[model samples]
Structure formats: C-alpha cells, structure tokens
Target: MAFIGIDLGGTNVKGILIDQSGEMLRQHYLPTQEDADGAWRDNVRDMVKYLQNYWQKPLTAIGLSAPGLPNAQNSCITFMPGRLPGLEGFEWSTYLGLPTYVLNDAHAALMAEATFGQAQHCQHALLLTLGTGVGGGILIRSELYQGLGQMAGHLGHISVQAHDDERSVAGMPGSLEYAIGNYSVARRSHGRFSSTWELVEAYRRGDPLASYVWLSSVKALAVAIASLSNALSPERVILAGGITLADDALFEPLRAFLDVYEWRPGGIQTEVVQAQFGDMAGAIGAAGFARKQHVG
Candidate 1:
C-alpha cells in the first residue's frame, strides 16, 4: 500500500509517495508563499491531487506534517504563526477529502527517527531540530508523548542561561536556541558566514572566532541535553536539522561535554547521534502515521 506524506514549512512544501517499507516512489517540492491568504491549504490539496494523478494504484491515506498545533481531531492547524497565515483553525482533512493524520513537524520528525533512523531501537529518545529556531519532541517507550495542549516538548524554550541580555525571546532569559541555533552561532562568531557548514569549515581551519562560537554552542546544547537526560533518562538523544551538520566539530564537543555533565545511574551511557534520514524524516514519519490511522 502506498501513502502520501506532506511536510509543510515556512518557505516550502515537500511531498513524498512511499510504500509500506518507507521507500520513496516519488517526490515533489514547491515554494510556500506567505503572501497568499489561505493558499497553504490550497497548495496542499493541489499537491495531493498531483500525486494521486501519477500513481497507478490507489493511495491508502494522506499524512500531513505541519508547523503548528494540530486540531483536536488531528485534522488541521489550530495555531500557526504569521508565516502560515490562514492555517490556524483550518480543517485540512476535510479539505483534502481523505483519511488524514496530522502532526506537529517536530513530533513527526521524532517519529520518523524512532521508527526508521538512528533512534529505531531506542525505547526513550529526544529529537532536536536546530533550524531557523529550535524545535523538539520526545518519545518514551517508542511512543510520542504529546502533553496537555499538545505542546509538551518545547525543549528550545528551556532557559539555559540566566543573563540580563536583551537577545532573549519573550522574556525567557537565555533560551537554548539563543545559544545553539544557526543564527546564534553566526551572531556570536561575528563572521560573514550565514550557515553552520561554513562555521564548521572555519572551525576545522582553526579559526579562533569560529572555534569560540562552536564551543559555546556545543556547551549550551550539552547542558540542555544533560538536563533532559537527568529528567527523562532517554536511551539516546538524536540531533536532527541543518545546524547539526557541523559534523564532528559539533558532535565531538557535544559528546565530551555530555560526558562531563550528564549523570547516569550505574554509570550507564547515553548515545548521542545525528539523524540518519536528515530532511526527509518528517515526510517518512507522516507516512507512517497515516498508515496507522488507515489501519485503525
């Protein structure tokens, strides 16, 4: 059976056609325009229609990974930001005319990793995606934990530093995102580089500013992960998204910091690894969730 997965983001919408084994049979991508009111939902419907037109067999279900709180019935977005205007309170399942399973993008990414990526065998894990901002989700015993209001896993919002600096968002002093996110690295490094890859390369070349910025980011990430480890005792912490692509420069320092700070009972170790599926994890997880809903 084939499933259609849609990953809706601020700047683009990606779709994938996958079978039961998670193989991508087809894929599509298009720009996401913030200017068009209600255009996001229309784009999704069009994308689903386009995918269905190409497949020879009937699709089992459609899964949507969106960047907001899904409605109570898991049908649509209830609280999207300005980037996705007209998404809030939109009932996507009815609009698409299909059995749909909608999930927060971060949560869907966690599901993808737990089922098919680095965290596949782990019983407890935390997935963090460090992009324009930081997003996070938690899986315990291989089940997604959607807390009350479906907003329990905002790890980036956790205060890690107690500075009186005005850079913090919404009065949350020193958020993890402020320290470890891509923009944070750029701001701290004072380099013209815009992406984490450039910063990583600079660090590799032994650039002093890049080294300082990278170390600070890794330290903040380690502190956050350690606190999470102490609280949840996850078997593994998976780092996803573009920022973590800094490769060994980021992971090595993060691992060393965790080793020093994290406390484990009986000296048990928690493995920290990058996500295997990279950007496609959300789509895969959405497909998986859609399969489950169809089966039930």
Candidate 2:
C-alpha cells in the first residue's frame, strides 16, 4: 500500500510518498507562502493530488504535519496564531476529499523517529528539537501521548527557572526555550553572540564569556531533561534540530551536567542520542502516522 505525508512548515511544504515498508517512493517540496492568503494550503492539496496521480493508484492513507495543536478529531489545526493565518480550524479532510490525519509538526518529527529512525520500536521515548525555539514530543506504549488540547509535548515552555523574569513566546518564565533556543542566544550572551554557532565558536577558542553562557544553557537543558526523566521515565531521550550539530560542545557539557542533576534510580540513566532524520523527518513521520492509522 502507498501513503502520503505532507509537512507544512514556515518556509516549505514537504511531501512524500512511501510504501508499506517505509521506503520513500517520491518526494516534493513547495514554498510555504504563509502570508500569501492561504496559497500554501492549496499547494499542499495540489501536491497530494499530484502524488496520487504519480503512481496512478489509490493512496491508502494521508497525513498532514503542521505547526499547531491538532483538534481532538485530527481534522484541523485548532490553535495556530501569528502565522499561517487561515490554518486554524481549517478542515483538511474536507478540502482534500480524503481522510487526512493532522498532527503537530513536532509530534510528526518524533513519529518519524519512532517509526523508522532512532527511536524505532521504543515503547516509551522523548524527543526534543532544539532550534530557534525548543519543541518536543512524547511516546507512551508506542503511541504519541497528546494530552489535553494536544499540549503535552510543548516541552520548551516548561519553566526551568521559576524566579527569572524573562518569558518565552508561550509566556513561560525562564523556560528551556529561552535558555538554549536560538531565539534568546543574543540576550543570553549579553549581545556578544547573535547565534548559538557564534557562541560555540568562541567557546572553542576558550572565550570566558562564551564558555559561561554556553555552559549555563547546557546546564539548564540538563535540569529540564532530568526533571522530564523523573516524570516520564523514558528509556531514551532523542535530540534533534540544528542545535545538536554543536556536537561535543553541547553534548559533553550536557552529559556532565546530567550526571549532577539527574536522579537515576538504581543507577539506570536514560540514554541520550541524536535524531537520525533531519529536514525530512516531519513529512516521513506524517506518512508513518497515516500508515498506522490506516492499517488500524
């Protein structure tokens, strides 16, 4: 059987066609014109139609990954704001004339890992995408754990420092997003670094300020991971996004801090690993989800 997955991102709309074995048959990309009066949605619809025709065969399932909370029914995105203006509450299934399952992009990314990437076959796992902002997803018993309002995976918004005054985009005070996300790198570095890359470069050169700022962010991340481990008790924690590219500069300190902050019972600590898929994870994951939902 064939399945289709489309990821609606701020910059691009990525679509993929995959077979039952999870092998991609074809892929396409279209610019996501977020401000072009819902043109992006039309592009997605057209893309799906085009893919359906490519094989001249019926598609077993379809799924969409978008940057918002999917409604309980998975028919539309319910609460997206400030971008993709017409996305909120838009019924994709009705528009496409097909049963289209919708999911949050972050969740879709995790689904990619769970289906075919690093976390494949993992019954309980967690994923964190550390980029412009932090985002994540949870898996419980091999199913995505989308809690009330589909807000369970908004890990970046979790507060790591209760006394700090700075707030994240989600109105969280001293959230993990603010501590390590690229959005707050400048402020965290006192205007010395505009990006995490620059800060890491300086730290490589033994810059004191850079070392302090970078280590501090890593420490906050460790604290967040430790707390999450205590609550979720996942066997593994998968890290994704551009930030993980920092390699040892990020992981080395994060591990060191985890040793200090994490409360591992019986000395069994959760394993931390990087994600396998990169930019295409969301689309692939959406397809994986569609396959699962379709088969059931």
Candidate 3:
C-alpha cells in the first residue's frame, strides 16, 4: 500500500508518495500562488491526484502538513489569520475525497523524525525549526503531544525577556523568536543586518556589534531551551531550519550558554542535535502520519 502526504506552505506546496516502509516513491512541488483565489487548493488537489495516479499500488491514506493551529478534531485549521486565504476551516477529507489526517507543519516535522528519522527510537524528544520564525513540536512516549487546540509546540513564542516591549506575531513580548528568528534581525540589530546569515558573517569577521547582537540572540535561545528542558525533560532536542546553518558559530555559543543555564542533575543533560531532514521534512512527515493513522 501507498500513502500520500501534502505539505502546504506560504510559498510552495510539496507532496510525496511513499510505501508502507516509509520510503519515498515519488515527490513533486508547485508554487502556492498566494494571490490566486482558491487556486492553491486546486493545485494541491491536482498534485495529490497526480501522485495517486502515478503510483499503481493501492493508496492507503492521506495526510496534510500545514501552518496554523488545527481544530480539536484535526479536521481543519481552526485559526490561521493573515495568510493562506480559504485555508481556515477548509477540510481536506471533503476536498480530497479521502480520509485525511491534518496536523500543524511543525508537528508533522517531529512526526517525520519520530516515524523514520533521528527520533525514531526516542521515547521523548523535541524538535525546533528555527527559520524566518521559530516553531517546534514535542514527542512524549514516542507519541506526538499536541495539547489543547493543537497549540502545544509554539515554543518560539515563549518569552525570554519579560520586560521588553517588542511583541511577536503571537502577541508574546520579547519572545524567543524575536530574539533569534531571521524575521526580526533588522529590528534586533538596529538595521545593521537584514538577515541572520549576514549577521553571522559580520560576527565571523570579529565585528563587535554583530557579535553582541548574535550572541545575545543565542543566549536567549539557550535560556529558553533550558527552561523547556526543565519543563519537558526530553531525551534530546533536535534543531532544524535555516538559522541552524550558522553551524559552529551558532552551536558553540549555544552550548556554552546551555552549560550555564541548564540544570544537569547527576551530570545528565538533554542532548542537543541537528535534524537529518531539510525542506522536505513536512511532506515526508505527513506521509508517515498518514501511514500511522491508516494502520491504527
């Protein structure tokens, strides 16, 4: 049997066809066309239909990975303001003509790891996707933990600076996202850099301002991670997304800060690592999620 996973994003829609063994059989991508009226849905439907027709085997199930919070039943995104028009309250099963499981993209990323990637064997793990903005997912007892309103993994919205006036998109003041996310780089650095990569480059050149700003962001991230570790006590933390591309520059300072901030009892500390998958994680994870739903 085969499964189809669709990852719907602001810029693109990615779909994958996979077999029972979790190996990707076919993959495709299409532009999201945000300005078009309900055209993106047609594109997604076409993509899914193409994948289904391309594979000769029986199609077992379908899954979707998308932005915003899913409703209690996971049937649709209950609230997704400001983007992906017509996505909110849009039921995939009704549109796709198949029983479809829908989940937040971040949760789907963790599901991918849990189903086949680094967290496959982990009873407890955390995944943080640090891109334009920070997002994350949680795993407890090897199961994805999507709390009330499926809002459990909005880790970046957690505040690291309580007194700061800056507010994140989630209405969080001085959130971890604002401190470290590429979206706020210009505001955080007083216009010195437009992107996190540029800031990291300047820091590499021993630019004092760049060093101060970048290190501050890393410090905030460490504090947030340590705080989360205390709360969740996961076996490991997997970091993904573009910001992590900073490599040693980001991890080195982050490690030092974690050493100071983390409470390692009996010398046991939560391991922090990089994610194995990249841009395709959501689509792959959606397929994995669908397989689980189908088998159960």
For lDDT, the strongest prediction is 2
Compose the digit string of candidate 2's lDDT tens values, residues 165-247. 99988898989999999989899988999999999999999999999999999999999999999999998999999999999
lDDT of 3 at 283: 92
How does each model score on TM-score? 0.91, 0.97, 0.97
lDDT for each residue of candidate 3 in 71-116, tens digit (9 for 90 to 100): 9877888888988888999999999988888999999999889898
Report the Cα lDDT for residue 46, model 3: 89
lDDT of 2: 0.93
RMSD of each: 2.1, 1.1, 1.0
Clashing pairs in 3: none
Deviation from native of the Cα of residue 127 in model 2, angstroms: 0.5
* Candidate 1 residue lDDT tens string, 1-296: 88998888777778888887767788887766657877767788878888898887888889899888886677877876765767777776678887888899998898778767787788899999987778889998777888877886778888788673635544577888888777665576675567777878888999888788778878988999999988998998888888876778888888899888988778798888888877777777787678656553
Query: Quick one: RMSD of model 3?
Result: 1.0
- For model 2 the TM-score comes to 0.97
Error of 1 at 53 (Å): 2.1
